[model samples]
Target: MSATAKKGAAKKDGANQPFIYRHYDQEKLRDALRKMYLIRQFEEGAEESYMRGLIHGTMHLSIGQEASAVGICLGLTDEDQITSTHRGHGHCIAKGADVSRMFAEFFGKITGYCRGRGGSMHIADVSTGNLGANGIVGGGLPIAVGAALTAKKMKTGNVVVCFFGDGANNEGAFHEALNMAAIWKLPVIFVCENNGYGMSTSVARATAVPNIADRASAYAMPGVIVDGNVVSDVAEAMHEATERARNGEGPTLIECKTYRYRGHSKSDRNRYRTKEEIEEWMTERDPIEAFESQLMEFGVIDQKGIEDIRESVRKEIEAGIEFAKESPMPEVANLEKYVYTEQA
Candidate 1:
């Protein structure tokens, strides 16, 4: 597909309800908000099915971090690139991956993305400009760094955004990649979605610094900490950082403070955190609700418009499930077809 196939229309208002946008336009705000809502509904649908045994492999849902993905994606162009972590459905969608094919993969259908070979963690989709989602904790950072290096070397005026969790900050690869990108002044954005935990271990136990962005100082770059729960803040920071990269600047580390409403995976028993913590995050900091309220207040989009958008997303998800269910599975004879880089 062409780079502009799924290209987003430029937005200028950056405003939404309850509060107006200081930097972003209303259209961009609406687009990001809409994408975030689609992500929420899509993940919730996956959760409902995963628990019912329709999904075979482990599924990681980023229910509370919609703002991080959408906000960041809003700042990027189709020519720019992104690399995502294990829990990456939101990234894929925000970057314009096919929702139907994603659900088909989740359902293990032959028509699925990856042709039913790769499951949740390995969904790569180039047409939409989403490189792929990494199963390893820090695998994507280096790949993004390499992509950035190439962009800088080729003078494409494009940037690469690397999305990972706070847990990945501890990985040696993460630090190494940042160091390289810093020195090279690569057009990259290292976005750390710090939801207070690395798998089950809280961020407090994982790091000494109060904020992950503070580490950017060590690399001689700007480190920004934004309220990940608020879409406005995330969009503002990402837009500026993106422009910074395009203007021949180094990378930026954006630490988005958010939360995950679900457990680490479908198998998790939900015992790592207190009930109060979970409930507080969901009730007070839910990104979708927060942004929806904002949009409503700003009168950018009415409640009915938002509801209609959500309903459309929900129906699309259901159609994907149906398409996956009716589709065929991978043939036994072709089991090794996609396992290796080369074909027979």
Candidate 2:
């Protein structure tokens, strides 16, 4: 069936709302759904592992922000690069990192991407164009800019997508990187995942401006806002920004106004926000639920399809955990191998 016709079939209350991929191909929509499901399931499994004392250190889960990661990465090519924040599993997975390796990293195994030393917040897969996830709030900004600058200087067509939280918007690195990128017309896209709270403090109380995107003007670049909950919306924005960068027009700042369904990290008590607010985001504004409904409405998938995807994701996560369990721990002999380098 045509994608739009599929949407018509997924109606509720005798009305048909917009589907993200109504007019697009079904494979693309299906792939997106599968990726989102994988991210959600992986994070859920990671949480379980953490609770079970299998993973050391706390993790910042991106449980509700799958759409932003998948959407933005959809606009990037294999040659393109990305930098992620501490809550970055979704980004790594969406950028084509192996789930087994990621799980091994969390388990601190020698087979992991960072040889098990970086742990949860510092996963890096250079093969997939992921520089690394930064533990510091805004640490990845300048690195992304440097990557873009190198690409620009070398005349490479690749661009860099830098993902940061709203909290990073207030950092000096953000301003410095943006200014340099704009002036040099660097191939970079600054994506701000504004998930409301920056470690218990709400954005309203933290920032002077209403929207972080507005600050892009000071750098002489186009600033756009997208519904971070809608994968298609984010994809469109990223596509525009990426195109602008590839065309030598300069960097673009995209503010994705999203929400986190979980606490900021394992230690977050969630005291600053009420349960009602989280419930609203989880039940009503859930990106996965909304996308599933739209897919059903468009006849792209049914209950069976959704269940199948969930089951497959579950199995994949289970296999990853098993692999992690079987992987060997990092030996003491190589403990300082990657920690420091000899000066040239």
Candidate 3:
């Protein structure tokens, strides 16, 4: 039977289906697939450029954690704000950032975000409600809380999503921020992308709690866990958390159990984890491949559609690189322009 026919049959048989299959239509699901591809390809292109010395400075790549980023932001609107981590290209893309501008920023061109002053880790688009990516561990936590408080005071009804790594859970800021948000009933969702390791240290060694989500109970929030490799699962958790926040029920802490193919950053030698483990995650649990299979199985997309998306992303990446190469750099005379406030 065809995929749709199978879906119909399953429905008639009362078989439980993924939340996305019931909630999203074909177009949205396909678009989610496309965004996941875009994030992957964009990071690949960035890594290539960084290796070639076309881009300066080091970067943290969230290569294998695409689904967690895309899924968490899937239910968020343009008005919804997010605070990202150093490894945040995926989060930026999932929240609707332009690849060309991101590439330009990496290239240190004037047309880029922050006018090239802020590179990969600092890219921000207020227009899309991406407050910005933070370099410090757990730095964005308090900032997200502040934004949520503003949204509450303004009655904007917009929720703020805070994306942090497993390492940040131990930071004092994490505890303080969560406690404050919960006490105020702020519209914020604390999303912990637990990829098993905090740099070289295993999460098991660092955290006392077995799962990062368990930490949420200390703050009096609903703690939830989901398979981060599954986009639909992430989306379902985010959707519920978002609704609760909008209803003035306070924040939710969601832990996404995922993996990253690359090291923590360009400087990481990856001595802590074994090659076999990385290979297993990459080959068996690749988020994009798994999501694509889900799409095909649910009749959302076929091989040709997937190919088309890949090709389009390829062209866009190429164009972005070219644009960065040809774009102008910042003027030497304007060094202090954006740094200090001007007198009226």
Candidate 4:
């Protein structure tokens, strides 16, 4: 069948997908696809490095949550800020963090985002409005609130997006931060990338509420539930939340129901979840696959276009890995440089 006929048939059969975006331009959609593919490839590289014993510290992989990361960040501008969690490579990359430096950070080279001190969990680049990814669960919440407060006080017209796991939502910091933001009308977006587990503990076993967004009602703000696997759905939700924040309404709590294809961390084995469940998510409901299908149905790109994007992303990641490998390690004499700030 011809490409036009195929597209027409898909639409007739309702294959165009329900989350059709009206605001996002064609270039933006293509860029979103590229960014998501880049995050996937970068995580794959990190896994390869981890298996080879090249990386020292442990790393958390968000292999299945790229849609949530890219979707939300697509709505944010360069001036907007974000806070990230341990599994924050996607978040950092979405916020325009340099991949080469990120790989260097993983390699513990001096050229990394944290100058080789923070490793994977603690990567931070304030220049791109990514404050940092915190090692502690729920740690980024208060930091995000603080950034929002700063933006509010200075009238910078910038919004802060905080990316935390489902596990972090139960912490006291989560509640306190949301309450404060609501009361002060802080321009912040609290995004819950609920990947179904908190380091082996299922959300059903830990969280009391059925949905994490339900907690947002306590703060007297809007609570949005997004299909974490759908990039367009996430982007639209973030756009609405950002608009509310920019209008000085208050903070928003968004729960994205996503899943992690791999284990929680490097040491984790397939103990809690089943193999069938993993296969289902990875094969059938994979975010990248779903997004590609939708893009194709929308006539945004053909199969050749998809392949080209993937090839380009693969080369970019390979270059980043080479950059990290050739970078110099931190000098012992400069170990304490970033530890303590000198009095100005």
Candidate 5:
């Protein structure tokens, strides 16, 4: 059924139904679940490749925070842009990136995004509206505001989603960007994926506000908090924010209270968090599993359908790795090709 039709049917059935069921059709919901799985499997593949030395440099994994990534982008179109963080593989996938090209980028092959120069921390797909992932903390905030300003000036009616971690809340750019976005009435959504820690330091140690969303009040915008583990909840919050932005009501700050199963980066020793805490989140609040159960309960998908998605994702990841392995590498002589702009 069409989304509008489904929404009408849902309203006729019951108002208490989750926003996702009321807004999105079954096909879209299933696709959302599939994308969540893809994000999880893609990260796992990248992690394995990194361990085997196929990928160079370090990568931050968003293993347990799949729901936040997928849910936020659920209502977005290709025209709606997003700036991602270093742990941005999930964001790229959520924004409709090709896994093969992503794997190629990780392998530093010439066929990769940014011609293999960007790697994991800098993957950008303009066609999919992903501006690029930044390695620096709080780096994407101002960039997102810039994008939103362009949209507002051009009357494009497109919104920009800026994905940052809990640590970025303490950055000067975060406050500046939020204030600027608010004053300009820009179509930007500041999504704080608070995974509890900024490197070894927890949010409690780094941030003063009780929740990152609370800071939005200072900017004179609405602040929302959602269960990042629950895809429906995240989607609901994102949908509301998107509507508000598209209506020219200015920006919104959404804090997704989630956790990362892995360390901050590949080199992290994970001494700050305990094993039981990580295990509890992984076992009890695994985003993909929670989403899967939701899909099943809502009759959106069944066991066999879920298995099919898993199998499809597995094959895709295998093919993506092979594609990267078979792809060509950039020559040493052309190292400056994308580095410097030639004077016209």
Candidate 6:
């Protein structure tokens, strides 16, 4: 059965209605779903190999965080910029990174994007305008703010998308970054993927603010909260924000309320949550499945088309695995390569 079939019937909610500014076409929505599937399958494959000891390092998988990544990326331009998170493979892929090379990075092969230097947390594709994914919490936000400032100065009109988790929202850097972006009217959209929990602790325990978006007012910008599991809603929100930014408006804070199915990292047994909780979210709130249902309702893709996409993703993943396996490991003497800028 397809992953969509595994989820129970979705409940009707106000969040299900299409947004006024939703910028999704048949091709765009289909590509969004395809990107989400690519991230999901890649992370699942990475988890399996890591568990089998084939993957050597620690990995922060984005198993349940697909919509925030792909949905937001859907609104990005080819020349636009983005900063990613510790769980960054999804961001990389959504920003147009090569799947084979992404896998090769995890395999520690020389051909990996970082030449096998940075693992799952730090994969990047500069040509795609993905600045880089950061392993440190709140690290990317300020960097994105800087990028936005540069864009504003250059009068480029290109927006910068900053992807950070709910945990990073509490960081001092988060507030500072937003404040700076707001004051300067920088073309930056701060996306908070609030997946219920930060590491093992639920958002309730870690955050006093009821809504992360609500805090945007303090920064003197618009704050919007949307169902993160619904790709159309997120795409709408991001679209609106980017347009406003390009028009010389300020930044917007978007809180994407969603869930993560797997443990914080592969290391945790997920003792913080119950099986029932996981099952509930999985059955009702999976973004990929939710988007698939909407696509079918709109006749964007039928069963056969969905299956074809699944098969295509699977074959592509398998090909990536084979390529990574055949790729050579980086030379020992090149340990310090790509780490520092070369002297003139």
Root-mean-square deviation (CA) per prediction: 6.3, 4.3, 3.9, 4.3, 4.5, 4.2
Q: Candidate 2 vs candidate 4: which has greater TM-score?
A: 4
lDDT of 2 by residue, 168-286 (tens): 99999999999999999999999999999899989999999989999999999999987788787788788889889999999999998889999999999889999999999899778
Residue 236 lDDT, candidate 2, scale 0-100: 76
lDDT of each: 0.83, 0.89, 0.91, 0.89, 0.92, 0.85
Model 5 misplaced stretches (Cα beyond 4 Å): 1-15, 342-344
TM-scores for candidates 1 onward, in order: 0.91, 0.92, 0.95, 0.94, 0.95, 0.93
State the lDDT of candidate 5 residue by residue for 105-220, as single tens digits. Answer: 99999999888889999998889999999999999999999999999999999999999999999999999999999999999999999999999999998889789999999999
Instruction: Encode model 6's per-residue lDDT on 110-223: one tens digit a residue.
Output: 888888988788888888989888988999999999999999999998899999999998999999999999999999999999888889888889888888888899999999
Candidate 3, 168-270: lDDT as tens digits: 9999999999999999999999999999998999999999999999999999999998888888888999999999999999999999999999998899989
Instruction: Arrange candidates, best lDDT first.
Output: 5, 3, 4, 2, 6, 1
Looking at model 4, residue 257 earns an lDDT score of 87
Candidates 1 and 6 compared: the better one by TM-score is 6
List, residue by residue over 1-344, the lDDT tens digit for candidate 1: 11112111112233322222655677877777778878888888787878789888898899999988988887677788999988999999999877788888888888877888778888867777788899999999999999999999899999999999999999999889999999988999999999888889999999978889989999988999887777767776787788888898889999998899888987788788999999988887688887787677666788888878788877888887788778888888988785668845
Give me the candidate number with maximum lDDT.
Answer: 5
Candidate 4 lDDT by residue in tens digits, 1-344: 13224333545665344444467777888889999999999999989988888787799999989999999999788799999999999999999988999999999998898889999999888889999999999999999999999999999999999999999989999999999999999999999999999998999999999889999998999889887888877887888899999999999999898999888888899799999999988997788988898888778999999999999999999999999999999999987897678889
Which order, best to worst by TM-score? 3, 5, 4, 6, 2, 1
Tell me how candidate 6 scores on lDDT.
0.85
RMSD of 4: 4.3
Candidate 2 or 5, higher TM-score? 5
Error of 3 at 269 (Å): 1.3
Which of candidates 4 and 6 reaches a greater TM-score?
4
On a 0 to 1 TM-score scale, where does candidate 6 land against the true structure? 0.93
Q: Locate the minimum summed-lDDT window of 10 residues in model 3.
A: 1-10
